[model samples]
Target: MATAKKKIHYAWWTLVALCIIVGLAKGALNSSAGLFIPGATQELDILTGNLTLYFSISSIVTMIFLPIGGKILAKYDIRSVLIVAIILQAGSFVAFGFSNSVWGWYIFSIPLAVGGVFTTVIVGPVLVNQWFKKKNGMALGIMGAAGGLLGAIAQPIVGHTIANDGWRAGYISLGIAIIIIVVPTVLLLVRKSPQAIGLKPYGADTASAVGSDGAKEELDKGITLAIARKSSAFYSLFLFFLLITSIASFAIHIPSYIQSRGYDVSFAGNAMGAYMIGVLLGALVLGFLVDKIGSRNTVYLAMVLAIIAVLALLLATDSKMVITLATGLFGFTVSNSVGTLAPALTTSLFGSREYSQIYSTASLGLAIAGIIALPAYGYVFDFTGSYTPVLYVILVLLILNIILVTFAFRGKKKLLTQGHWN
Candidate 1:
């Protein structure tokens, strides 16, 4: 029977499905947030501070509910969750088009956060962990890189749509498109586990399962959420998580930040494109490099690139060439924010036993950073008459990130040796 059954690998198919789902979800939604900010403000006559508050509200919801979302994922069908998630997130985006009052945005922000947790945050890592036992970092990097590729494709289209179709029509069209594109892919290709297709993880052969002691060996798993929560390593990882997110959340404000610097709106949009393209390149490089050089060292290199990038933006905002170079560099550096640390660090410390729950709980850092960082950057510009302060602030965070990650890994080493952990 084993010889007769045809063998097919689900891992590659899973990658394709992720490239499509994640590509569409992030490329369409995140890249388009810039397009909506101005329109939502102008059409509703809302202040920039309050309009941005809506995004913070959504982040707050995500932060507050991520653990709940994790527990929910534990119980439910991923396909069904993803379908509903895409609808709520993208659907709420579409609802912004029809919104007349600020109250509409505030209300829809609830489901939007809940949905985003499922589709954007938890889905890729969880699914990848289930499918690939080897080269997991590369898988995560590819997922992040796909988002970059899609953003490259989608942002210009989003810009064009907002420029030509008006914001409402643009939102409506893209929202519906996200659902139309992702739901079918999810239903057709996404399965919760490799066993659903009659396979072990890509490299897990029974031949390798026996230990020298004549005992059956099992895969080492990650630290449970409970233990991870108590350690200095977790807090260090948390700070790194926060710093990286602040860097990316700062992306949402780049177009506006560009405008504040006496540059034209068109230039701002183009700079964003440059930034995302940089992110794409960086993701692929870091993912590949991490496997070769190791995760901690790769992080150091990326952080240096990010610091240089942010400093360039501070000093060279007027030069289109320099700003473009800087934005791209920063994009590359920050792309590793999602691509590398969470899973790599998790597996390095624990193994995989409570992988999903541990990662999900830690991801509250992401949600919380979005809430605090987004408007903090905006309001800095609002009150201070320039973004220079925030740029200086980001420089500090990047440096601190390097320290945090170093300490987190160092602590992990101690934990492993002491037999108190790992």
Candidate 2:
């Protein structure tokens, strides 16, 4: 009798879909926003601070939507939700091109944030958890690295487009491209659960078969949002999100920051490309490190890199190479705030049970950082005439983040001792 051949797993396909969708969502739409600022301000005749407040508006919308977005993801069809989210998110990017005033950005930022809260902030972690029963850290890292690689490509393309055709055309073209690519990927590849295809999650069987009993117990371990809310683990994770994001918020200002230091827009764009390369390498390294060395150690090392990057930026003078290298290192280390770190940290403290709710709730820190940090950086530049202060503040936050990560793990040990994990 002939034997049937084993089929390739669909989880890998789902990962590819996420990589494309999330990568484009972040690289083409979110990161590209920085490139538009100088040109947009000149044409619209708006102050930089005023133009960037749209980020604040977007953040406010994200804060309101994140919890609700979690519920929507749970209750709605994954394909349908993603398709509509792309339209809303990318469509807003296209709409920004037609606007002649800062108010346009302010208004459209709502839909942008509404859609982004799902696509950018929540979907990758949630879907990875539902699909991958092992190598979860590596999977998250790949997702982030994909964003970095795509962002590397998009950054230059966006800069060239703006330089040649203006921000208006750049925005419209990028939005159209994202919708075209992401919609089909979402419809064809993304599934809510492995059960939809009558298969167990990738690596689920091996994870169970090879585990020590302690490992099995930990897999069964988790706490509800109610319990997590009351735990120090949750709060420490929240502050981690907040501080890390506040630090990473500098990316949006990088174009302006470098320009202030005497680099041109084209050079600034190239620096961002370098930054993306850092993101790509850093994401992969951190992912592997999380599995081998653990999240806490990985986090400590990342924070130290962040401080070095900050110091390089602060002290480096007139050397474009030095500034660019510093910026790249900064991007590599700080990108983890939203990239692998959030999800990895979440898993370390909370386990898998009730993950979606806890992750979404913890992500409020992300939204809050967007609200306060982005605009604050912009306004500080507006008033103080330099980004110098911002760099110092980022360095301080990086040090503090190491402490927060330590406290968070300690909190997890308390939960374990208190029977919360049982």
Candidate 3:
């Protein structure tokens, strides 16, 4: 019996490469930012509020660059764009190693943010949409899970390195390693679209009639960005992005919060490892739920988890075990909102037409959240000697997100009724 072996789809290969590239960018480089704060502040004699202000600068740059970066990604070769992006981002990290003053961090944060807009913000969702016609939620979830797994490993290692070798060494070593790994991955595996390889996106056969022309027609179906911008769903999605990002930015303060609660840095490192593990599990579960239950219900569930996590954090600070477990829970909720859920929600509400433009424009909230939330947490801690107020604010925001999700779906209904959804 000479049965032919069916070739594996190249989309899976593209997904694998994306997992590595985005995982390293987010897990190793971005997630490690908080770990350096204690060492950088203590050794350099910088104020916590002052040292973290660089994060605001980075956000400002990100806000300015997001729309521009989106356009750039759409126009350029994916590999070339990602290659230059990694160098800018990782190169900035290397520069931070040589910095003895807060000003160095402030200055280099520009390029760091500029590069991050492409690698962290736009690339994963854009590529996933381009490659997977079905199970795109699962693909995004897998990518997020990969980031979480890598972050779980990287967090502890980075913590130990900063503890043993100092923040400078930690920064330079990590930066160099990421650049070495990512450049080749982007060059070899990343492509702009499935059509570039003369193949349809994954599940394209099931999604539409069997022909290139039909697939192309199916892909373009959705509300135009112009009309979408006028809808309530767009505004609600923007607020969701803003509030969720504001909540997630609390991650950068978790280590400092631990230290303030009289825990040692070693314990903080373990907590962060727990957090990443939660993120890994959360991404997988959220992705599955998005596929099965839809994005709105999935988000409702995530918001409930967040409410519990915040309540535990507020009420159970005396127990170290509770703190660790609550932190892991918090990580699970935040990872879903920021990494897995946001893109899924956007796709569900708006469809794929003008997705990159719509997503990037709405992501101004993410940038604005970073600018305000990170430093605000630092300043609150600096002034009040507590993160308790910040926790309360997060609790309120989580409830509001539940409301926003409902409104976003309602707005989508309006669009459908108006025949704006093609």
Model 1, 216-290: lDDT tens per residue? Answer: 223444466777778888888877777788877878877677767776545665677777787788778876777
How far off is residue 2 in model 1, in Å?
15
Considering summed lDDT, which 10 consecutive residues are worst modelled in model 2?
Answer: 1-10
- lDDT tens digits, residues 218-301, model 3? 767788889988989999999999999999998888878877788777677777887888888998888788889999999999
Off by over 4 Å in 1: 1-11, 67-77, 133-137, 191-234, 264-266, 346-362, 406-422
Q: Please report the candidate that would top TM-score against the real structure.
A: 2
Q: Mind sharing the TM-score for model 2?
A: 0.87
In candidate 2, what are the lDDT values of residues 276-313, reduced to their tens digit?
88888888888778889998998998899889988988
Better of 1 and 2 by TM-score: 2
Rank ordering of all candidates by TM-score, starting from the highest: 2, 3, 1
RMSD of each: 3.8, 3.3, 3.5
Report the Cα lDDT for residue 354, model 3: 77
lDDT of each: 0.77, 0.87, 0.88
Q: Give candidate 2 misplaced runs (Cα > 4 Å).
A: 1-7, 74-77, 134-137, 191-216, 222-236, 346-362, 406-422
